[model samples]
Target chain A: MKVASGLLAFVLMFSSQAYARQTFEVDLQLEARVYTENALQSEQKDASLSLAVTPEWYRDWQGGAHSITVTPFARVDSADDERTHGDIRELHWQGVLGQWEILVGISRVFWGRTELLHLVDTINQDDALENLDGEDKLGQPMLRINYVADNGSSTRLFVLPYFRERAFPGEEGRLRPPLPVDDNDPLYQSGAEEKHVDWALRHQGWVGALDYGVAWFSGNQRDPKLVPGSVVPVMTPVGPRLQVQSLRPFYGLMDQFSVDAQYTAGDWLFKLEALWRDEFNSVATALNPAIERRDDYSAASLGFERTFYGVSGNASDIGVLAEYLWDERGDEGSGFQNDLFVGARWAANDVAGTALLAGVVVDLEEYSQFYSVEFSRRIGSASKLSVEARAFHDVPPEDRSFFLVRRDGYLQLEYNLYF
Target chain B: MNHPRRKINVLAAILLSLVAGTSLAQYDGLSAEDKGLAIAREADRRDLGWGDSSATMNMVLRNRQGDESVREMRNKALEVADDGDKSLIIFDEPRDVRGTALLTFSHRVGDDDQWLYLPALKRVKRIASSNKSGPFMGSEFAYEDISSQEVEKYTYRYLRDETLNGQDCFVIERDPVDEDSGYSRQIVWMDKAEYRVQKVEYYDRKDSHLKTLTFHDYQQYLNKHWRAQRLEMVNHQTMKSTTLTFADYTFANGFDDREFNQSGLARMR
Candidate 1:
């Protein structure tokens, strides 16, 4: 209830400010999902719902010499058999100064170039806490700065201090096994806890028609250790005692270095990237006493995009991407995973004002597939509506082998208003 | 009866020829240099008017690889004053660019002061002095390219007489005294009879071919002025081109200088 009230107040305040400005924009999204996976014991269908709202305000000043814009956003979701209320998301603020830009507060930073895959798995979110990351050792307190060069090139740097972790408040009504928590445990207290600072630097440049960038980061890592058969006395029934060791806040350096390049000529664009990281799974997994020294990982991705313009100035774009990851932490020498994805997007400026997009992703190593489709229409001068659907399934490599039936799908509806 | 009618017709024909000869004699005897000077003077006189016109501009931007992208824009302009030193221009279209205003103070043979009002930023920024040669909105038109042509801005010398587009024209070469101008000199071909600009070739500081502009589809307005409804400019180095289509000309509009002020820009919407 407090989260709901706080989110409501934030929205109202920002919305009023946006209304005062002649330039304003708002985007609202509502999503519904149905899950049918083998991980569920009862073979029952579960439904989940979520809502997100974002509002922006802009004003030009100094005789048009510069412009200022502000955006505040929030979200709410409900799941768990539709009986419990959803958690409220955090608020975020973003500002731009001429050619320079800055982003503060809590927001998702989607970097990297893997198709339907993520190479830099630095942050993990909590399942039950909609906006919070239960596994993260740091809450989202980050500062990002960027500088533009004379030749239309740019560089950016980011500094984030802390990590977030989730802990059970009590022993009753536990959804899963609780981590072993003693008085000496560093992350014993509950909810979200901050740990250490993470920093990164990136430089982007253009060589002829190709755009390229290299980024590097050093940060606090998550170290999760699994103790075999070492049950602890948490004083709870029905739930198993899982001895999960959480390493203390140690002074260590976990780094990720990457290089990305893309070239766009006419209607065709090609991109490629390679990422190297220090650990596999969670950074915490590397801290286990049994195997704490093995920490080398790498991933690479390549993609191609093309666009076709129609007679009426409308355009259609198609893109395909392939990604591969080498994880030394997997079974045998290392697990090699690959994902292939293809997408098609259409934009038309006819009377109907319609846009459509569809995509398919196939995970070759895991034998999983994901499909998505979306359509949008402009309803009025400042209003638009969109609908989207996504489906995921797991397939077995051989026909004679038994396959896990993992089916997760969702339907989303969104409305946007611009001024 | 047939003889009398024939004599009457012959006399009328002779009278009409005498009148045509007298009118033609006024301008035909002038030297080529004087003819060139006369064309420039006529342009200065007729172009000075408070008029509003709408134009559709098209630009084709080509790179070294021969790749191209085309962009189109519609413009509405009001020329408020033409005192040879100052002019005010107001544009009102392309909702994103509406409410924008420009004030230009032109000197006879010196640099011009240009101020632009951007409604989105609510600020009237004075354009830097060094950017006069930069392309206007990434188009072939440069900041210094579209200013009013004053007689003193350039020194003209008649090159020769030439047939341009099947019409006899006087080719004049003009050298600009302003050091900031992107072009050192320009060669212009004007129709001797109509005083209309048929073609112009621009030469860079190194005397290299920079661009060419061709005017066509001339229409007489108010019985005193001829305006071309279509103009095409092609940049040789960039391999880019721009086409301008003009229409809806309203002459002698009662526009005041105060209407082009910075405060007035905010109220344009």
Candidate 2:
């Protein structure tokens, strides 16, 4: 928190400089969601409303060779207090010197080619409360140095000094497990905990139609293991005694190597994202003796996308996408282990910029299915409207992840105003 | 991405056709197609030696009701020695799309390579450049209409010579060779003095008149290249129009290939 405030002060100092070319803007979003069924958890709600505001300020000097951007975001939710939060989406100063570029402060970086899963994009911690799609990320503090070659190849080195813990839905939040997670008490394998410094290196280049990147990261794992923290006995109408336990997040240090590539051929794009990780004390062994330690794991996602232009002689395009996801841990891995994802995207290509995307992910072993649809269009010059729906089906009771959200189907609507 | 440079090239071709004073009678006995090819070659030759250029553009799109929306962007181009030009475009307006950019590596032949950088996601995505007929950003200008026009992409024929808008012009008809092109053919009017294209009429696949584009306010840069400051494209069928206003045209900037690559796109200001 001190670092965040210090960066804010630095950005303010730069923006106050009269000679700097500065611009300010804000985005306000109103969102509402309705569930199709009642939540299985006692504190969950069937409907919720949220409002988010993000303000951005940017200043550039030295003829754009040096610049700084500051964007801070805050949200308020009616249903879940945990969902209401604040974050610095971006607050960074960037400098370009001939073939070299340097960035300092907090920022977000995405590194992946596949659509179904982003195994290689691990720079920022996931802001899960903002969205379930894993697209929203919290800004990470770092010092980044990048070098570019004449051939368009680039190598980036990152020194991350702090780690941001991933946010989860609260007890009153929808799409959460039966027991709410207690984030205040998190366990870490490293004594330095969240203060452990992380490092990452990536080199990316393109050859003909193919673009590829390889990266190495040493840091605390982004995804956390939920272990039973405390149990309390409660009185029930049908039973004399029942025990309920809340989950605690556990972070472990790990080294990950990842590679991603995309090959473009006409209207078809083939993409691949693969990663291998060696973990130390992957789980809280002292807390959960029944769980076996996972020392190493490998995961991969491969996909292809094909777009058909002017479908049916109209100014619209339809793209079909398919991918296969695999994890060496199989059923023990995330819900995406051994899954197939098929999706379709449609764009109207009109002044309104209308678009629709729909997809389904099916587990190969348990036959559990998750379906999603998203449609968005520009409302006017400075506003947009979006609608989204998600549903789960045939979720096996034995599946630990999907089973939690089996009855949490929902429809969401969002309106954004930009100025 | 390089639409500004492409637009300049379109105007440059027109200026060259008028500047080069080649004798027309040299091809008196040749077929109309050969004469047209000769004229195109002369225009291409006269437009060389530009090296590199950059410009800013303000695009206005108007619907049939006359409601208008504006878009602003910056473009930088590097003239490749043996191949087509490589260029980059950065969007600055509509506020929401600020910092979005595109990079293009056009080829004299075959498909061009293009990439789009989305700043919000911090991702660079390679997009298919095969949508030559699709509207660019919902504007009346199609992708093919704004891309760098290589002479080899079309077959030309000299139709006739006439006076248009107080200037003597040579009118020509060109048919696209790509089977997937949205146009059946295009008719161009090039001024006799500067060879700058004053107007273009497009025919759809059904041979129906679709759109007409007119250039205005021609200016000479470096005393060698002619650029149209304003280009208006009107879709005859939809009664909609798009106008592109260019400004701050700078040439001979000595841009290297590194400046036109994907890395430069993300850092475009």
Candidate 3:
């Protein structure tokens, strides 16, 4: 919290400079969703309202060489208490000197090539409360330096001094763990706990027809292990209620090396991402593992995407995407091992930006399947409407991955107005 | 004249005449194709040395029902001595599309390289060459139409000289060299005086009329080159049209090759 305040002060100091030119804008978004089922059976409501306001201030000085951006965001959710939160999304000062550049403060960084899973993207912790797709993230505090070579390749080094815990849905919220998690009690292998200074080095460039990124990270893993802490039995009005206790998030230190690449030739795109970790837990082990041990794992995913332009002689495109995933841990792996993911994206090249995407990820181990379909289109200049449906089938009762929420599927209709 | 100076002038004149004679003889072939090739070569040679340029552009799209939308952007280009050219475009309007940028490296023969930077995701997307035929941002213009058209990308033939709008112009038909191009051929009208393209008619793969583009308001820049102030394209198949208005043209911006690299795209603003 002190670091966040200090960064806020620094942003204010730069913006207050009389010689600097400052610009500010407010990004207001109001979204309402009508779900097909009750939210965790906690209420008689089938609708949820979410509002997010992000105010951004940018101060550019020293001509085109120096600039600072500060964006703070807050979101309120009426249905789920854990989804309501406030955060400083980004507060960074960037400067360029010759062929070198530097950035300091909290920032969001993304690195990946595929859509199914981001194997090489581990910079920031996932904001799970925002969505189940793992597409959103919280800003991370870092000091980064980038160097450019004459050949167009770039090298980046990031030094992270703090770690932020991931957010989870409340007990009353849908698609949550069986019991509520206590965010306050966290255990770490490092003596410094959350203060452990983590760092990463990355190099990005093109190799002939392939654009590639290779990175190595040494830090406390972002994903946490739920260790049972304390249990309390209470008497309820209906009966004696017995519930599990608070869970401590355990952060294990590990080193990960990853590489992601894409090669586009004519109408086809070839994508691949592979990584090796010192030690990490998949959803199975991290949740209900009979064995109390884990080992280093290696995983890789390869995919290809191709599109048929002007399909049926109309101004539309349909893209076919298929990928195969492999994990050395096999069935004891991340549940994505030996699985196949195939999807299609339909695009209507019009003013409305109409599009539909549907995909299914099939587990080869147990043949359980999860599929989703999403359709979205712009309603106006600053508004959009979308519908998404997700379902599961043939999921075994003892499958650690899907046993918890095997029946928790819903369809959602959302409308968002942006300002 | 002094004996040494006179001797030197005589030698220089002889050498200059010999070079000029050889250049003339090189085009002495009787075939009409040779003459057409020479004319195209000379047309391309005239616009060789403008180092760099920057321009602000506004694109207006109108549908058959007369519904209209607008997109505003800025473009920067750098000339390359070899290979093709490198250019960048930054979109500034439509609120949602602001800060979006595109960087393209056009090749003289094969497929060109392109990348788009999306600000919302903070990621750079590598666009496939097959998308070259698709409409640009849902406009009437295709990706290839908006790109920097290099002289070598097409094979040209001199059709005839005609008068259009009371101005003498050369009519030329050019076929795309790339087999994967969406355009079968393009017929262009170029002014005789300036060698600047005035109009073009495009044909699709089926050899049917596709779109027509007319350049308007040509003005001289740097006292040597001509810049079109506006370009309007009409799509005959869809009954849609788009107009691109160019303003604030500046030349010789001292842009170096290092600035056109892909890694520098996001930092351009």
TM for every model, in the order presented, reads: 0.48, 0.91, 0.88
DockQ of 1: 0.03
Task: State in Å the error of residue A65, model 2.
Answer: 0.9
**Docking model 1 quality class:** incorrect
Candidate 3 per-residue lDDT, tens place, A218-241, comes to 998887777665556678899876
Please identify which of the two predictions, 1 or 2, would achieve the higher lDDT against the true structure: 2
Instruction: Report residue B27 deviation for candidate 3 (angstroms).
Output: 7.8
Interface RMSD of each: 15.1, 1.4, 2.0
**For this target, which candidate reaches the highest DockQ against the unseen true structure?**
2
lDDT tens readout by residue for model 2, A170-241: 988987878888888888878999999999999998998999999999989999888877866677888765
Off by over 4 Å in 1: A1-24, A35-45, A58-70, A80-115, A118-140, A162-195, A221-253, A280-293, A311-336, A349-353, A396-405, A415-419, B1-269
- Cα lDDT tens digits, model 1, A1-419, are 99999999856654554314245645565655554342323423355566756565555432222334445545564543222222212233444355565656553343433333444434322322231112212124567676655454567787776554333211111122233222124431213335456678877655544656788876644333322222344545777454534323322345788887666554455667777767432223333444335467766667766654432321222333333444433323212345567787665532234668788766566666667788987653345677877665665533111122233355556665443
Kindly report, for each predicted structure in the order presented, the TM-score of its chain A compared with the true chain A.
Answer: 0.64, 0.92, 0.86
DockQ of each: 0.03, 0.50, 0.48
iRMSD computed for candidate 2 = 1.4
* Tens-digit lDDT track of model 1 for B118-142: 6433444343333345455445666
